[model samples]
Target: MSQTGTIAKKDALAAHPPAPPWAELDASCQLPVLYFLLSGLAWLLVGTLLQFEAGIRLLCPDWCAVCPAMTYGRLVPAAENALVYGFASQMGLGIGLWLLVRLGRTPLVASGLIAAGNVLWNLALTVGILAILLGDGTGHAGLEMPAYSQWMLLAAYMFVGIWGVQTWAHHTSGPYYASQWFLLGAMFWFPWLLTTAQLVVVTFPGRGVLPAITGAWFAGGIQHLWLTPLALAAIYYFIPVITGRPLRNYHLAVVAFWSLALFGGWSGPARLIGGPVPAWIVSAGIVATVLLLIPVTIVALNTGPVLGSRLGQVCENQVLRFLAVAVFCFVLVSLGNALNALRFRAAVTHLSLNEWARGFAYFHGFVALTFLGAAYHVVPRLMRRDWPAPRLVSVHFWFTIVGLALVVIPAAVDGLRQGNELNDAAVPAVKIFDQLRSVFGWRVLGLALMSAGNLAFLTNFGWLLIRCWTPGIRSAVALFIDQSGKSVTAR
Candidate 1:
């Protein structure tokens, strides 16, 4: 009860030191996080295959003429929904939740509920995809899923998102990092954006052009507000750790964060520039899209030095290489968006494959790559094992890069050519059609390669899980034999 007694107690506790906080947190999160990751990778493979199928349909219109569900209209929307809702959203949630708990130094709250919600979310997405294939698509860009399915998705998201909010709240007294801010913003922004879009476009079915306007806005918000922020959250957090250097331009990260938050939602209407929507809305979108250059510039400058200093590491580390590619794609996508939003550039790119090329680059090249890098880093920690095969990872990265370049470059270049020719009445329509056929052929190849990459990743993920749980499996078998001379469940 004296000072000497207290000092001796403290010294003993320090020497022993209970398990690290991250170890405890990772143990709590293993079930739900692993479930999310596994489901996400499965969906990634399914989505990529669907996309490849859609590309084939584009090239050969009569490829699947007999099957109504395989029609181009149904297939395209189905593929997009599968990739965005099924793959990207699920992966982002898994990665974001882990980042939230790790950066906040807090235990996961309501992990059981998150696991249940994950099941519901995937179920709802499955229903939505089937609905689209069955010709029940809402005919909206991002809101193609039917009204009933949309509500279910929203309900499921809340179950997971609320816990994220609570985790951040539990650590409110601690200093917040840029990554936490981005993750928090994404968690809050998606539901609001999805709800508003559903209300205007699907639930209420606004008058003619209004639904179009709402759909454009919703799609843009998904890209800029939801997906972009989720990707950046991982980028900001992992780059420094992977490079073994502190984030440079620390002060500017705040500037980048606030700038992105302010500008993202307003940039959606740029898609409707030449449409029936009011001119002011279009102007606002264009202005916001251009202003996005601010954050884009800040991000490049901020992370550029850290990445540059570790060029050798970037080449040596697969995850670092992925992150580096993500940064480059982010800059490219932002600049392309700004330039294409202009009146002249929009005139050429508005109704062409140029837009599709940009979307592919942004979604697959930028966002998906960032999430993949984060997954490579976090999965090992959670599983308590390193990747079983490094060669598979290298194959995945190269396939992704080469495939993306194939898809984006050919489609973009040909799209501009097609646009310019279409504008000039003198150029024959057949000429543009021929060029499109070539690009579609290239896309088919690219999608095939990308799908192969997805399979490689999924296989690696499965292999890692087998390695991680093998020890526990052996322990269980040994313990069962010692206790009861049988490996039967105890009643």
Candidate 2:
């Protein structure tokens, strides 16, 4: 061909590159994945409302005092369970399954079983939340769900997990990505944590401080081992894809991964520092929590340069912005946890709302935000449609950033104040709690903003689904109308 002809061919190819071959894989799992995402978003809204209600009650004890179910004891636990299991875990599973199939270069297997398991899991959560509200909570911090509910969750997990493992096992030949490792770890780690909590703490009824120790361990594992890993899986997978570059320091990713798995579970006991648990256990936990910084720092180092290099791209792409913020939150939360675990700091902060602030930052700011980015990238591809409202995405992002700031910063500062006051013999507990009413007000405002963000997401997703399905609905209606018209003409 002549030079002009070749040049024109190159330009045409640049204008319309070959399409990615992801359509079939995405289609195969579309229904189940969409179900998980939608239900997860619904649960997030539910949990946020409950959180807002609980915050209000804290500010004014008489606000909901008439209803037993609205008591702080019941409402707080129910909210935590709903947010953790109903929203975070369920959403993480959906995202993880997609990553597992995509990264493995394989079609989804056992999708029917996976969907059934997903339904079962949600049903179990609903029952457990109701059980807590009705005063059937076991009173174990993380295992508040009753014994039967725990068993049901475990069974539901087996149906999902067995197939996940099988899918991973049968993955097509390729070098594994870092996301796969984290996804697989999460799939296995959650069951172990839940089973142990059920057996040792709930089902078997451990003696005295053993139950407390076990509960703390279980709670910690859920955050560190299960939720954080799932978040990281998305982070690792999406960062490079969005930036159109390989992750920097790729060699060290394995070290970071293993170190996290090693220390994440052990860090749980740090929460028990001032409790009646064994001093040795507490000391071990402190060490583990501090060591967690190694992996956290490694992650920052691995991803920071690439993100820094792509500052323009990061700004232009909404998903990249979410992952960037997630990384920052992950680093900040890790450092805060390490500092809080120290004996000197833990002495004052123990039993204060400082821990609450940290939990919120980690869960909402880090993990959930990461998933938000993932949803933006994945949902559009699955439906073969772009977001119906780009502006709603921006609205969600801003609301989350501002809302998280309002919630975390004020709560953390006030928690420290409460902790310091509690340590002073001269200060009365009543005065310290009385001062917290204002802090609770700020949290309520934050929760409202966050809930608005959730609503925006839900609305955007609903619109996208409707747009995608509208053609089919219209076609079916038109066919029926045509048949009726022909019959009338014959008559």
Candidate 3:
């Protein structure tokens, strides 16, 4: 308690600073993350192909007219389901688990269980997509998988989810990191939302319009609780690391976290603005959605200055570039959602392509981009090799951004036009469909470009894997040369 004793304690602690949390982890701990990432990429490829097929069908209804399995109604939902469950969820789990271990200062226990769970998770998604194409879909938005398939997904999630919970439980340090909170919240919240949706709309079939209400709720929850947190966690971790600065106003992170958790779950109902649901439900949803801006703004403020300081790095570092764009998209989508929640805008955008546009913006533009950036960082660390080709990374980045802009802009513009036309009783439904032909054509083109970008990603990932297994191909360190003109290894 004396001044001399306090000074001595401080000096000792500073001199013997603790080791980095990640240093405790070994290669075995990385296996689960790699498995999840590889599986996610595979699903992403499948989802992109399905999206292209669905887009083409929209543009030319008769392209596969003879095959009921290839019908737009079937293909579109299957594509959406695959992207959500197969690609997004799988990548999220992998990235989240890895971050938790690093931040929590603990090694991941139950690696085998996590791997097995991921296998079941992918298998369930496979079965679910097949069932949708084969006409056994639940017909609920965000819950399109058959009941049997849903159960399989949930069972697999149990194993993986347990690993996250146990990892958090085993943390050996004080003052939890921001990434840890978001990762833990996402891991716990998703299964709860999924199970509740199933029970309400599947097991105990809602009456009349109840199914629609529940479906809207489920869809909203997926974005706000699951996808948003996963993306935010990645952003929080990368921003500080990439910028070489601790977060500003770190204490406010707790406030931001609680605000999102409390408000996000209820925010889904805003999409049901004019539905048969009670007026209060719609009002509650709108308020919650608008309130979400608090947390979004907090995050932006926290990372803005740090990221701004490193603007130059964005061009040089592939990971930083992807992350910068992802953060921008996150803010854009959040504000857009708040604007869309208004009664006037909701009336115009409701049941229109605008919803699809927004969904794609969040999933592909924000969440998927974040995952891709994280992969750029995590893959090199795991494989101990720098990316084989910087050109491939550039190709993937530019194509994805351009493709998303093409898709989102056209979809929103056309959706607003369609909504206005639909409101005009004088406009015939057939005329509306005819007017959308050009928009659908643009969408098809966008989807094609997006698929091409994904292919580049796959190719790069494949090369990295090959090099990881092959001996003496090239040391990741040798990929770069130091100022002295000698080969320098990347750390």
- TM-score of model 1 vs. true structure: 0.93
lDDT value, residue 153 of candidate 1: 95
Q: What RMSD does each model have against the real structure? A: 5.9, 5.2, 7.9
Candidate 2, run of 10 with poorest lDDT: 10-19
Highest lDDT model number: 1
Residue 438, candidate 1: C-alpha displacement in angstroms: 1.0
* lDDT (Cα, tens digit) per residue for candidate 3, span 231-250: 88998987777666777877
Return the TM-score for each candidate structure: 0.93, 0.94, 0.90
Q: 1-491 in candidate 2: lDDT tens per residue? A: 25335423432332224423465777667766777788888899999889988888887888768899999889888998999988888888888888887777677788888888889989999999999999999988888999988799789888778988888887775688899999899999999999998999988977889998888788778988999899999999888776667888888999988988999888899999988989999898899999999889988998899899999988878788888999999999899999999999998887898988988999999999998889887788677677889899989998988989989999899999999999998999899988988788889999999999999999999998888788777766776877655322210
Off by over 4 Å in 1: 1-20, 475-491
The alpha-carbon deviation from the true structure for residue 222 of candidate 1, after best TM-score superposition, in angstroms, is 0.6
lDDT, candidate 3, at 363: 88
Candidate 2 or 3, higher TM-score? 2
TM-score of 2: 0.94
Residue 33: error of model 1 in Å?
A: 1.7
